[model samples]
Target: MEGEAGVSVPQRSRTGLRTERLLLRQWRAEDREPFFALNADPEVMEHFPATLTREESDAFAAQSEADIDRQGWGLWAVEVAEGPDAGAFAGFVGFKVPRFDAHFMPAVEIAWRLARWSWGRGFATEAAREALDFGFTHIGFGEVVSFTAVPNVRSQAVMRRLGMTHDPDDDFDHPVLPEGHRLRRHVLYRARSAA
Candidate 1:
């Protein structure tokens, strides 16, 4: 189906979406271990305050699944849809509503967290493009935003590749982070619906 932006909408099922190379779907029992590893990897969690413990990782996954179940969309677990690693749990890529209030609160954010092996590939950008399309076309959101710590140029590059624009004026200190924290100041990027 054609969306308001005249872009072809991706095929979607309840709690799932398919891109050219990735499947954004609900969390699975098999995804727990790898997800925990991803969250615990200091390299992966470097942009955040700290790595997640196994329990914390599991709880986050459980909440993501429940969010998908209740709203038909949330942070969907991503899997390689085709290739040698087909069906392998890579990580997650999808939408999230930031719980804390900020100048950008009450907005949906496009985000991703992929395993280290998935880096250097176009998976994050590809999956995030589909998620953005779903949000604009299916959810009918007028805009979606993404943000990261000032040092996270990698994620900012993904946002830029997705056509999201960044404005220095829109930057804000993350409310959840303590004042003076290294990751407290964040750069916000926004993508507006073509409709």
Candidate 2:
């Protein structure tokens, strides 16, 4: 399926979603190396509490792979589909169910984390739009939400580009983080299915 600007909608296969420039597919063994690199990069992990160790990153990838195997959708490993970087592991852009309890518990979040090299090319927004489409059309989600620390303007901008709306009243401190943590206060954005 195609969306605005010729972006392909996500297919409900284990292969996962696709867009004009990305293939949001299941994680691969080869992806672990670069995935760990990105996860360990302090710049890339700036918004999060800390960089992930190799074991943490591998476990994350393993869980992502298992999720796709069982549910046919999860945090997909994003691959560059064309150009000189074709087939490169740019990073991930897909849906995740927040494990922590919050007012928004039970919501599926549209999220992305790309390599520093992939920044500024609209990859996150492009792949996320396709993932959001999949969540609405394929998974039957009435509304999908995204949240990030208050300082994460970049992600918030991507959220806006996806036509998601932010309501300050809906914002809340992340329950996963301890009180007084700098990253605990997060901004929430929501988008409802057009259907």
Candidate 3:
């Protein structure tokens, strides 16, 4: 459950499969510092619990790597394919199995986390499109889903761009979080196969 236990497709990078602007690749040991910085950013973590510590980031990165080995996909260190941060870690995008408390009808989800500096630039949408393509096409999943805190308009917008439709009725109080957590009320989005 700690690693990429439910990813059905073989993917190496969290950056993305590749678009004109981004390279979705797996995380490298060298990415730990920037990865940690992004995770520790308050604005970026605004929708989650408090920012992660460097140690927590390091441990998570290590586990992400293990997840790729186990399920062939997990969050990756994202960077521009050709830009100042092309080789640097900008953030991450990937897929994982939801914990039981996630209450997602589809059970598996495509997820992302990028630095504040990378926000509002279309990077999340682009990278996430690749993940959806991988999930629905190569991975042969019947559906793919995403979720976020009700106030996370940014991520919700990206989900819309990816053609995921909101199912407000699917919203639930996230069970894993403490009662009344500001981020506990979550909304679900879903996309089904073209086939």
TM-score of each: 0.93, 0.92, 0.89
> How big is the positional error of residue 163 in model 2, measured in Å on the Cα after superposition?
0.3
| lDDT (10s digit) by residue, model 3, range 144-171 | 8888999999899999999899877888
Give lDDT per model, in order: 0.89, 0.87, 0.78
List where candidate 1 sits over 4 angstroms from the true fold.
1-15
Off by over 4 Å in 3: 1-16
Please give the distance, in angstroms, between residue 52's alpha carbon in candidate 2 and its true position after superposition. 0.3
Least accurate 10 contiguous residues by lDDT in model 1: 1-10
Top model number, lDDT? 1
Clash number for model 2? 0
RMSD of 3: 3.1
Q: What is the lDDT of residue 38 in candidate 2?
A: 100
- Stretches of candidate 2 off by over 4 Å are 1-11
Candidate 3 — what's its lDDT?
Answer: 0.78
At residue 84, what lDDT does model 3 achieve? 72
- Clash count for candidate 1 is 0
